[model samples]
Target chain A: MKKIIQFIVLAFVLLPGVARAQEAAGSINDMWSFPVVYAYDEEVTWFFDLSTTTFAAESDVYLWIWSPSEPDAGNWENSSEFAKLTYEGDMIWSFTLTPTEYFNMTPEDIAASAGFWFRLKDLTGSLQSEVHSMAYTDYSSFAGSGELWRSYPSSPLIDEGVSILFNANLAEGFEDATSIHFHSGLNFWDIAVEYQSWIPEVVEKTQLKNMGGGIYKMDLIPQEYYEAPDGYVMENIAFLFVKDDWAGTTADQVLYAGEFIPPPPPVFTFFPQQISKKDFLGIIRTNNEPGINTLIYTVTAGTVEVTGEITGGVSEIKGFVNLVSALQNVDVTEIHVLVKDNTDRTISDTTIPLKQLD
Target chain B: MRSKIIYGLAIMGLIAVGCNDPDDGSYVDPVTIYEKMDGDWGLMSLNMVDEYAKANAIEPSEQNMGAYFNYEDFKIRFSVDDNMEPTTYEVMGDVPPLFPANGYWKLSSAFQQPNGEAVKIYLYSDAQKTQMTDELKLVAVPGSGEQMELQLVRKSGGIAFVSYSFKLNAVN
Candidate 1:
């Protein structure tokens, strides 16, 4: 009887602690669904950035969604295997689902309700992330817009997903095309994923999803879709939409990759516009690169030579040398100055004429 | 009538006492620039200026050189005789010789020039003060703050081009 009483006491003490631990660790940092735009019945993969949460990397994560509908209701403590998310490396997790199938609702029902809202959790609901919602992109307006093609994020990065919508009604020969395939390449055909209709896998992989009513969509993550080699820099994607195994095709098209603006160049200049042998010479450089913090300099006037170094960070490096004492009574019209960085890269080597003092 | 005469004499005596000059005490000798300048001075800042660039309105015409070549530890001392007259001057730190390190020194004027002309410190290489080495303009006289500024100008063809200004503070 005493053992039973002690067991009850321990259960009371530890149960609440376990309940508290089941609460959300943190909110998702970011959430996005591939195909940026999709129909309610179309398959899409929703990605979550869990880096900001307490969820361990590459851990088993499951979805517990409620609004639109909760197909896995009454099972929060033991999420179904179908709701399990695949762990993408780098603390990112993804779940691929068709809204209509996952919610067990009609397209009209899913669209009429509030968007996808859910918290990510581990099996048995012991640990979870804060509630988050996946963003939806509606592309229905492009049907009547009379545009041939449009992409969901006008510029796309190589590793991110991009959705390209096509208006077949506007194309000359796409009306009777049983299917459409993407024959694309990176950097103007430097690397290509050819649409070989003979290969069943290649044909299916390059096929576009027909959205009915002369509208179609092609979704891809450039890096994976092209199977580019390591360190492959994608400048632009060049391609055309082919119809029914070369029965017809659209004009050649190119989508330029996002622009990367490099940092401004470094600038070197002498402090004083004019100098004399009896004045201190100032060396200054601004907008330097990282780790280029020091400048070593050598100045020669007649038989006298002076050398020293100045140190600073990425913004600027500046110093002054005492020429008055070093070149006292020395006869010279100009002094040769050589400056190099800490890495021994020559920054400047030139002879500056000394201004005759009056 | 005798009472009136006594009152009148008292009034005149009181007037004479009030008219007498107030005692201002004896006169003391005025302080000279030599007395204020004769001491050990530590360098506070040393600036090199491009006078030609400044004349032409160019940017970055001046730079501070106090941190270079051991100038942070630089010191100068001026000695005077018991009469408070200028005698010898010496640079104390192991720094580059911007001027004659040790020399007999004298002021261009015993007192500040009333005409506003800058007084000069003339350095001589000999005790007899026959050979002149360098001259530095006393740009700022030592004031109540115990600080002074000296400028050495380099010139050619009677026009100044570059100059060095040394600002110093009394050590003790």
Candidate 2:
């Protein structure tokens, strides 16, 4: 008698569900929500109205939310449950998307889209609704709305070991910007040549000082690649601003430090522009260059070539170069001088006019 | 027609060659040593021959030289007239020379030598120019064309020669 009573109750409870599962067929008519203007990590509820044919009014419903990036049912990014409906007046099935649910989305996805698309299904998983997308225009406005407060120095002319100032102001979703990094190398022309294969040659972390109001200032001293062998020639450097808390990043772009200039072109002035047959003093004045230990110069005129070295300082080299043998043969001669720094960098090339004095 | 084309090419080559002027914007006016050296000069300092002997480190003897030359009480003046003739006046202790201490000087970029070519400034004691007091090799320090230094080299044959240096400033 006890088993019969339990079977009757069970059959009665499941009989209606079985019948409803076979007969009940309805399409999700529309999904409606309100109060689109909300801050990040704010929870909101969505209402779904279903047009039923033969389903009971007290059936259970489930809500499935998805990121627009991957909207397939197998890969439904997220899901939420709607409370049981007890009120008989309005057959409105509603789902509450908690703040934790919204925060679970990836930063990249939240930055890209205002709201996610969702689908509705019953507990049996037999009947499903079509996929629909919704966006909170007010809330979505804050997504991906990051912009640079001030323009970086456009092609600033800088020297090696000089302090370069960098300032940026972030607003909206970029409020958490904690650090700024400067990525250099891969010049303007190299980017085109390497195409997508370009990577930063050097990355330097700049120290930042907060000036409130989302404004950050830093003095970046680029030690690496400052004295590059080829030297900097108006090459473009990229600065990346990152919010480490959420792993948010600003797109990489060129700072255009104007041009990386090398020491002034090797220049020299020679005394006695007019050298007589008797050996006269010639002072070759070379501009001081960094790391220059010796100045190797070649004096070439007509067919005579004499190579000499200045060991002490590159600033000035004074001595009597034995040009008597070289110039005694010609009436009026032109002496070509080629000078190079210790690094074998050509500093200057000039010619001196000499005449045999009577 | 072929000859006409050849003539056109020849004319173009000649035009290109004529446009190649290496002396463009490189003209430097050459100033002779006589022009730059014609100024009033005063001796500033002197490098004593050997201070080691004055320190009482060496024994007293006549061979120990006290000093080579002293110019504290004497100021020499050089004058170059428009005729290019040079004259000198030696003043001793605010008193002018009693006998018109006149001398002649010459500046030349070359004096025939085997190896080194140097600017030689010759100072003769008389108008007839029989005696010479000094023959200095003037080398303008690199970068400062206005200043000239004459190294007070010693009389030793070897490495002791190039030790002393004297500076001459242009006061005029």
Candidate closest to the true structure, highest DockQ: 1
All DockQ scores: 0.42, 0.01
CAPRI-wise, candidate 2 is: incorrect
Q: Which 10-residue window in model 1 chain A sums to the lowest lDDT?
A: A16-25
TM-score of each: 0.67, 0.29
Clashes of 1: 5
TM-score of chain B of 1: 0.87
Instruction: Return the lDDT, model 2, position A83.
Output: 26
The docking quality of candidate 1, as DockQ, is 0.42
| Consecutive 10-residue window with the lowest summed lDDT within model 2 chain A | A192-201
What digit string (tens of lDDT, one per residue) describes model 2 on residues A1-358? 9999999999999987677643234565655542223333445555666654233455766655555333224532222233222223256666555434444655455656645665555554565566666544332322234635333233444332222233344434465456544333435434321111123322223334444455554443233433443333445555555453325556665666554555465455443333433333243545555455576788877777878776645454433355544555555456787877677888678877554322
**Candidate 2 lDDT (Cα, 0 to 1):** 0.48
True contacts kept of each: 0.60, 0.00
